[model samples]
Target chain A: MPEDSKRPDEKNLPRFRPATDILERADGFYLYLDLPGVSRENLVLDVKDAELMVSGRTDYRFEPEERLLESEFGNVEYVCSFTLSDIVDAESVTANLRNGVLEIFIPKTSKTIPRRIQVEYQGE
Target chain B: MVIDFGGFGRPYRLINELWKPSFLSQQSLAYPPLNLSENASAIYVRAEIPGVGPDDLDLVLTEKNLIVKGERRVEKGRYFRQERPAGGFQRMVALSAPVDADNVRALLRDGLLTVVLPKAQPKSPRKILVQHG
Candidate 1:
């Protein structure tokens, strides 16, 4: 289903409380997400308008008939949202998830870049 | 040092001293391994939070500190005895430098949480050109 059509009433839905880092460079920005237990298989990254959506699930439960020893953790899931600023180039955004970390790179718009003015040299 | 109280009057101090090491050991054992570094521009934190999902974690930022809290729910299988403590935990740290709270990011990879905190604008480096005579 499209992320924009997603209403507030989805069950088994991942909850989002974003913890993101923004690294500004001469040309762009890097946004990193701490989404643990999320695999590349279950991870979803979506862009809607100026908002970025990140959601996933972590499955740790085994078969019911299996022998159990210790258990403190329950099922795992993820839900986080980011509202990007105008400086972000939404079209150029790219995301990658490796070893549970989700990294999104957003290149800055041309307007955000500093333009250098040419210096004129007059012949004496 | 050993102090024997009469009959059932065991020295509470003695019990405390004896169990102090044990209690310390349990706490040390329960704590996750963590490493942190900071510079004028940002603070970096890495924590080992294995088998936990994003929903199990919480991140908070205050005036001078950042807190990471979450629960690790270990699954129980059949025919086994449970021993390890599960549920959740929390850790708070005072930052080494003032950060641009508007631009903080966190990533979880391979059971590790990595946070990158950007420093305020004034804390950034200024380029100075040298003029020679």
Candidate 2:
């Protein structure tokens, strides 16, 4: 696979940092990224060494006969990264993209979750 | 505003949080960035609107103008970083050429909206050969 088409990483074009929201829960963490114009096939996600990287590219190709009158969006890329803690179980991470938004699930280890400890009636 | 992650402080750090390029900063707030184009037979309009469904969008096309209105709703939750704004927006664009109102088509897929309007009359040009007198 050619290095250019295979990966979402692009250096020559302009890149934008996607607007993001990170929600935390006892069970796991949910990350939402607004990546408009990026298709499912153009998204790239990687988790390595406690770091999560997300990159997406949008392609805007005009036909030969079409003439652009007004322009705002063009060929651009979206990139955002996050640093995960040790408690986060990287192997179980999962993600999905829908309606141009990317959702990532980062589950933590069972030991990290706060739990109620059952105590015997030894005080009685 | 930044929020703490489970009271353990903000574990997630965005390295590029302040690295916004000036060229696109103003364009970001202008919701639903659009592209208007036209060919010999039809006009095209495309808008990038993520997280919005077909029901949330309303489009009105007339002889000389096109109006787009839509709402983008974000789920309520405890957010550590909230950057994507959620609200309703309306934008009106002027059409360069007249179009067939009855034949306009709108399609939504993966958060991109594409509208095609066929021209009122076919503008295919013909070459007339000049004969020697």
Off by over 4 Å in 2: A1-11, A113-124, B1-29, B122-133
Per-residue lDDT for A21-96 in model 1, tens only? 4455455665555555567877788888877877776543222233222211223355656667676688989888
Using TM-score, give the best candidate's number: 2
lDDT of 2 by residue, A18-109 (tens): 77878776667888888877888888998878778888887555556887776656666777778887677888989989888888888877
- DockQ (0 to 1) for model 1: 0.05
Model 1 residue B98 distance off true place after TM-score fit, in angstroms: 49
- Per-prediction RMSD in angstroms? 28.9, 8.6
Tell me the tens digit of each residue's lDDT in model 2 across B1-133. Answer: 1122222332222332224353245543477777788998898988988888988999998779999899998765566777776899988778888899999999887778889988898568999999999
Interface RMSD of each: 23.5, 5.5
Per-residue error for A102 in candidate 1, Å, reads 0.3
Q: Model 2: DockQ against the native?
A: 0.31
Off by over 4 Å in 1: A1-18, A63-72, A112-124, B1-133
- What's the number of clashes in each of the models? 29, 0
